[model samples]
Target: MPAYFQGLAIGLAYVAPIGMQNLFVINTALTQPRRRALLTALIVIFFDITLALFCFFGIGTVVERFALLQLLLLLCGGLIVTRIGVGLIQEEPTLDQSVEVDLPLKDVAMKACVVTWFNPQAILDGTFIFGGFRAGGVAAGESLQLILGSSSASFLWFFGITLVISLFRAHIGTKLLKAINTVCGAVLIYYGMGLFLDGVGRVQQMLSSLF
Candidate 1:
């Protein structure tokens, strides 16, 4: 396969998992107006590409070297995501056909930014996946192609997620929407806890080395 195609494949595989970003985008699409939701996806896509470029271009290795930085990132990200998850769980979207909630556009955009940029798994994906490709002896010309391919994957995935949600909106009533929010919240909490634990593990390792 061509380098570009290879990169595309790698990108798709990495983004396929249902993580914080995916859940947020899906939730946004379901809850918000179409234009705002689409804009939210676009913001996430922009960050996704930016991170990929940062990692593939060699900053990822530098990040990996700093165990302290990694620990900080994990802890911060865990706390933030966990808080979000808790909020979601606590504030179950009202299923009443009579009541509707409209989240502010800025709020949605801010959340999208936090979920993408502050997500440790997302950073890891960029570092490990894209960075791995870079280390695999890709030529300079092919490097650009790879970056483009990976970016395209983000574009496709975000839009595709919203599209799927939009398709089933009418079929999925308030009850089903509540169920989806609950599920997303649970998954995020689980994911965030894992990140926190990982950070703790790293701390233990650091102390062990120091002693």
Candidate 2:
């Protein structure tokens, strides 16, 4: 339950979610070279941690208060994710499993940083939501160790995700990769639907609660 661990727990909840980063990471692992994938993952985690720290400190409050902001994000995110899933379903991986392409390291790193950091929800999730919870623990004068416990859990998950992706990349066959994509697509669709429903429920709940 050290402070480091506490920071890490905050890290996990943010990363473990199925989002654009996960899709990119998985796709890189399945398609690109190992080094490329690793670098991509590192960029992603670094961005997440930095954002998380920012949120926990203070920058996230603005987001937390903007009630309609999150709803708008969820709807847009759902659409984008669904769009990607549909694209995956339409294209078969094996048709172009050519191993000749290489991910431009500099570009990929820059792009990953931009995409991951620019994501509003990523900030909201890490720095605002999770960060607020951590701050409350700190404010309550909860044991630093206990407070850190959550963060450590999150850090471990980040490492675990990276390791798992790398390890699995070695053995993933073309067909298996396709299967994985299919499953991932389904997951994206489910998440999209869930988000849409949650948004609708919130509106309904707000209206009823108003009455």
Candidate 3:
């Protein structure tokens, strides 16, 4: 496939992994109106793109290497991820609430950015997926191009979803919102467990090899 098409395929594959951050952004947009929700989505995109650049560079090496580092990250990060997933699953969606209390774009953006930056899967995707692709024979520009392409898919899905929600905001009640959260959270919990188990297995292997 051509580089552009390759980028598209890779991008879609890259963004397909579901997570809390995406769920929150989608939920926010659907619950809130244009300014606040779009700000949230844009914040997510900004963090994702910035992290992609960071991982593309040599910065991720420190984390990618060393079994101990992986363990550290998994133990701390995985727990956090699992917690967020559980939180989402437990949340009672309040879809009936009026879309009031306008949040400033800057503040909303900053919070969304922080939330996106801290999301462990964001790191994994940026570091593992994007980083791996770039490390391959692909040109640097092309690698970034691929990442941007992938990011676009995320942007499109998120914004597209928000657009639909905004259009039908009146109809989607708490039950539907709760169902969405439950599904997203269940998926996230599965991913978090996988991360935890993978790290545990690596540690076990490292120990076995020591003897």
Best by TM-score: 1
With candidate 2 superimposed using the best TM-score fit, by how many Å does residue 40's alpha carbon deviate from the native?
1.0
lDDT of 1 by residue, 32-79 (tens): 656666888888888778878888898689878987888998999998
Clashes of 1: 0
Residue 13: error of model 2 in Å?
A: 4.5
| TM-scores of all candidate predictions against the true structure | 0.91, 0.71, 0.77
Report the lDDT tens digits of candidate 2 across residue range 161-190: 666876767666778878878888887677
Give the CA lDDT, 0 to 100, for residue 131 in model 1: 86
Residue-by-residue lDDT tens digits, candidate 3, 88-168: 789776655553847777777765664566566677666787678777878756765676676677677667766766777
TM-score of 3: 0.77
List the candidate 2 regions with Cα displacement exceeding 4 Å: 17-20, 94-98, 105-124, 127-129, 137-160, 167-170, 200-211
Task: Give model 1's TM-score versus the native structure.
Answer: 0.91
How far residue 63's Cα lies from its native spot in candidate 2, in Å, is 2.3
Better structure of 1 and 2 per TM-score:
1
Number of colliding residue pairs in model 2: 14
* Poorest 10 consecutive residues by lDDT, candidate 2: 139-148
Residue 191 of candidate 2: its Cα lDDT? 66
